[model samples]
Target: MYNKGTIIPGLVIFIVFVTFPLWYNGLNAGTVPKPDLPIGQKECVAPAAEMRDNHMKLLNEWRDAVLREDDRVMVKVGGKEYRKGLQMACMQCHNDKEKFCDSCHTYAAVQPTCWDCHLTPKEAASKKETH
Candidate 1:
């Protein structure tokens, strides 16, 4: 081939570019974040593993049920009734958003929009005090 030298170097460059991310990241997945679980709170609306994977879907469903269908959206688990929403339920137990929510969210590189509308427990209390 007349372009042997150029073709070989071009192929090398292409392969390096294609695999750049793996090389840069060292093929290491990253450390899993362990959020601080609530003390003395054993049960949840769903199991731990289920919630880790599908909390967003559950929250969206709850929102739809409460707003669209006019349902009260109360979920009972382990004899405790929980109102379906971030503020009323999830934040009640996971009160420290930075410790409980932010840890895992940051590790997963996600920006959850839940805080956009609902004030965190600490924020709500502080706002009430200010007013």
Candidate 2:
């Protein structure tokens, strides 16, 4: 290893660059976001843990079912029928999107596409009121 003087330092620099993020973040997964729960509503379409992990997947399935199969698709949970949609079903209870949705999503560093098509309940109401 005739080039050990330059090669060893180069290898060290490369390793540090590769592992910098892991060290900077202390291998610490960020704190779990504490989203505000819906008031006067004790249950969601799915259980809390399932929803936390797979809400996007569930929403995508709901979107497919509603758009491809039927617009009036209803989901029955805990003896209640909900018209499958972000606005119609989910937002009925989780009206404050900033508090309920944004908190968790921001922590997870995701930008959901749902808002591209639908307004938050508060926004919809404000627009309706102005009109």
Candidate 3:
């Protein structure tokens, strides 16, 4: 027969080990990403949820349009035509890509390759200031 004293302590240890992450996260969870609206703009090219869910898909489409299709970079969403370039267009509003883009990407565990080919807002500003 199992001893009640040993069994109870073992069960408690097992439960705590299994649920440690839940308690830890609940106590010290990171906040969700919140991008600020660009100056003079009320809304983004697409809806908030749409952008959150499918921005990568949209970027791939844009890349194909520009790199493959030769500058057919117009994306019409929500009755407005947006030129699908990160530096030329999206950066105008989301100036701090590190805070806005990287924060969310980090939270979601996605490693976006944009920074490999693009300058961050801070980098772009410094480059401009030096000239």
Per-candidate clashes come to 0, 0, 0
Show the colliding residue pairs in model 1.
Answer: none
Provide the lDDT at 123 for model 1.
89
For candidate 3, give the lDDT of residue 67.
74
Per-residue error for 12 in candidate 1, Å, reads: 2.8
What is the per-residue lDDT of model 3 for residues 1-131, given as tens digits with 9 covering 90 to 100? 57999999999999999999987898777787775556665677778889879988987877777879888566554456667788776776778777778777778898988888889889988999999
What is the per-residue lDDT of model 1 for residues 41-131, given as tens digits with 9 covering 90 to 100? Answer: 8989889999989999998887788779978677776677888777878877888998899998898789988878879888899999999
Native-referenced Cα lDDT, model 3: 0.78
Candidate 1 deviant stretches above 4 angstroms: 27-29
Per-prediction TM-score to the true structure, in the order listed = 0.79, 0.79, 0.71
Per-candidate Cα lDDT values, in order, are 0.85, 0.87, 0.78
Listing every candidate in turn, what is its Cα RMSD in Å to the true structure after a full C-alpha superposition? Answer: 2.4, 2.5, 3.4
